[model samples]
Target: RLQRDQELTGVDVVVLDECHERHLDADTTAAFLWDVRQALRPELRLVAASATTDAEGWSRLLGGAPVVEAPGVSYPV
Candidate 1:
């Protein structure tokens, strides 16, 4: 949707999952979202989620955003 230059309309948040993978498409999407947030929608909320991602690195890349860590979950095998 972003690459196609389509408007996000009523969407207020975007979640980028598996950011630790560092795939090209995901990177591009992240860049686009960052651009949109900076240039178009300053209020648009963006989230990058991964179990093992570099929280500080991503926070720096996202303009010094704060990092939130969640407790891991495990089930009996």
Candidate 2:
């Protein structure tokens, strides 16, 4: 967890899935992880992934990291 110090050590990447929900805990975790990436683990790969997320906003939050858009598929019910 990002709450613990040095918790992310040895981690190659951290993928926060379903970030579009935007809950309090998720927001805090994102902020802390961003801080960790900035101040401690510069090489730590961080990914905020979601199906219906605000890519631009998250990109800004993650220090202007590039937002990669993947092709989506839709099926009719």
Predicted model with the maximum TM-score: 1
Q: Write the per-residue lDDT of candidate 1 for residues 7-72, one digit (tens) a residue.
A: 566878899998999878888889889989888888888888999999999999888988999997
Question: How well does model 1 score by local distance difference test?
Answer: 0.86
Show where candidate 1 strays beyond 4 Å: 4-7, 73-77
Candidate 2 residues 1-77, lDDT tens each? Answer: 55565658678899999999978988888888878888888998889998898999989878798999899799999
For all predicted structures, in order, the TM-scores are 0.85, 0.84
On a 0 to 1 TM-score scale, where does candidate 1 land against the true structure?
Answer: 0.85
Question: Candidate 1, residue 75: CA error in Å?
Answer: 6.4
What is the lDDT for 11 in model 2? 88
Q: Pick the candidate with the highest lDDT.
A: 1
